[model samples]
Target: MQTLTGKTALITGAGKGLGKAVALALAAEGLHLGLIGRTQKDLEEVARQAKKANAGIEVHIKVADTGIYAQVKEAVSELVGLLGSVDVLINNAGILKVGSIVELPVEEWQQVIQVNLLGAYYVIHEVFPHMLAQKKGDVINVASTAGLKGAANMSAYGASKAALINLSESLMYEGRKSNIRVTTLNPSTVATDMTVNAKFTDGNVEKVLQPEDLAQLVVYQLKLPQRAFVKEVGLWSTNP
Candidate 1:
């Protein structure tokens, strides 16, 4: 199995939800972390938890909106300076805009696209060179199963994820020569503030997929053999 003990990972949306879970998991595995998010409090809390989980885990928190290219570029630059190399970039920052197409505000739709699609692009744009330079890395985009199909009342979110899925595939092929692995994680429904508040998943998270469950899968992919990689994987609950 590949060892991630001394590797560095940058996780967007690391303030909360699945991003936080993945950060803590990776920290436990001894990876230094660069946490990017909009909230200082949330990011700090996560950083604290990471330190508690692994005292040796180095953590750097940046307040940046992934939707903005300039912020992402600056944040990534600073993180790379601190950590030296970003061996993993987790593009997990996203938002939920649930409503009918016609009735939904245009700004809301745009916000979703900005954060969900362009956000991933911005981070990937900033981090790709490091991966290329190092000759090894992984980029994990946390998308949704909705991206694979047209769903009712999910125009902005679904479309953004769909574009992200395609982007992930394109990156996967482009980075193969440099030993970079790109993967898209399409989860049906996970217990997070985004899902629970939207009334999309069940209220009882114990019955459904949790953030830690998805984090496990992310770590599994990261631990795979160097010559092998998973292009895409979807998670679904038996009853939800």
Candidate 2:
């Protein structure tokens, strides 16, 4: 396994759930964290906890909407300046709108696409140049199992994630020669507010895949040998 110590990773949606968990795990390995989230309070809280995990670990928090190009561009530029360079980019920010197509508000559907699909695009667009310039980096998009197929009341969310998976695939082929790894992870039944709302799981987090479970997997993927990388992977809850 490769050592990630002293590297830099930027994670979107880092305030809660898998984002927060991943940030902490990365901190444990001594990677400086550049966290992007919608809520400043949550971002600060995560940063605080991350600092506690390793006293010398650096945490930079940026409040920006990844769905917005201007915000993402500005936020990423500033973060890169703070951290020097981004070794890994995790596009984990997404929204779930669980309702029938007919019943779901048009605005909500648009919002889902904006945040889930467009958001990932904007972040990748901003960070790819850096990875390309360096000829080495990792880009992990946290998609969903729902994206793999059509499911009940998942029109907007499913469509967004499906597009994200395609996006990851295209980037994987496009960037592989440059030695930048682009991967997509589709996790099922994670015990987060999003999954609980979808009624796929409950508050008993341990009975299903927890946020840290998904977070740890992403870290493991990042540590693989430079000569080998998984293009895409999926996670499912065995008990669920």
Model 2 regions more than 4 Å off: 202-204
Tens-digit lDDT string for candidate 1 (1-240): 898899999999999999999999999999999999999999999999999999998999999999999999999999999999899999999999998899889999999999999999999999999999989999999999999998889999999999999999999999999999999999988989998999776567667788999999999999999888889999988885
User: What RMSD does each model have against the real structure?
Assistant: 0.8, 1.0
C-alpha lDDT score of every prediction, in listed order: 0.94, 0.93
lDDT of 2 by residue, 15-113 (tens): 998999999999999999999999999999999999999998789999999989999999999999999999999999999988999999999999999
The 10-residue segment of model 1 with minimum total lDDT is 199-208
Top model number, lDDT: 1
Q: Provide the TM-score for each candidate, comma-separated.
A: 0.98, 0.98
Scored against the true structure, residue 153 in model 1 reaches a CA lDDT of 95
In model 1, the runs with Cα more than 4 Å from the true position are none
